[model samples]
Target: MKIKVNSEACIGCGACEQIAKDLFEIGDEGVSKAKVSEVPEDKKAMAQEAIDGCPTGAIQGEE
Candidate 1:
């Protein structure tokens, strides 16, 4: 799976980072960014939760 954060749409609320720190982080510009391009199977569930938790729908995953 691939994980991506839409920097233009992200509000940087930190939900993604908080829910899945292994996959995301808040940048110096205050937007959420994907720490990695691909999501490991072991981390997909947590990544989904992070995607769901994002208020702005900035986090996305593709399988």
Candidate 2:
């Protein structure tokens, strides 16, 4: 799976980064960014958690 952060929608609340630092991060622009291009099999659940936890619904997952 691939994860994407929509900069326009992100609030930079850090919920995503807190959920999965390996997959998401707060960028210099104060928006969440996907650190990985693809989610590892073992980390897919964590990525999903981050997506669900995003208050602004900025994260999107693509299978």
Candidate 3:
């Protein structure tokens, strides 16, 4: 699966990064960004957590 962050919806709250640092990061633009092109098998759960934890629902998972 792949993760995406909606720049327009993100608030730079850092919840996603805090929940899954390996999957997300606060980019130079001040919004959260996906760190990898795809989510690793072991990181899927964490990625989902980050998505769920996002205050603005900015994170999305794609097949």
Find the candidate with the highest TM-score and give its number: 2
- Specify the highest-lDDT model's number: 2
As a whole number from 0 to 100, the lDDT of residue 2 in candidate 3 is 94
User: TM-scores, in order shown?
Assistant: 0.95, 0.97, 0.95
Task: Encode model 2's per-residue lDDT on 1-63: one tens digit a residue.
Answer: 999999999988999999999998898999989999899999999998998888888999999
List per-prediction Cα lDDT, in the order shown: 0.92, 0.93, 0.92
Candidate 3 lDDT by residue in tens digits, 3-53: 899999999999989889999999999999999979999999999899889
Better of 1 and 3 by TM-score: 1
Q: Which stretches of candidate 2 lie over 4 Å from their true place?
A: none
- Of candidate 3, the 10-residue stretch with the lowest lDDT total is 48-57
For candidate 1, what is the TM-score?
A: 0.95
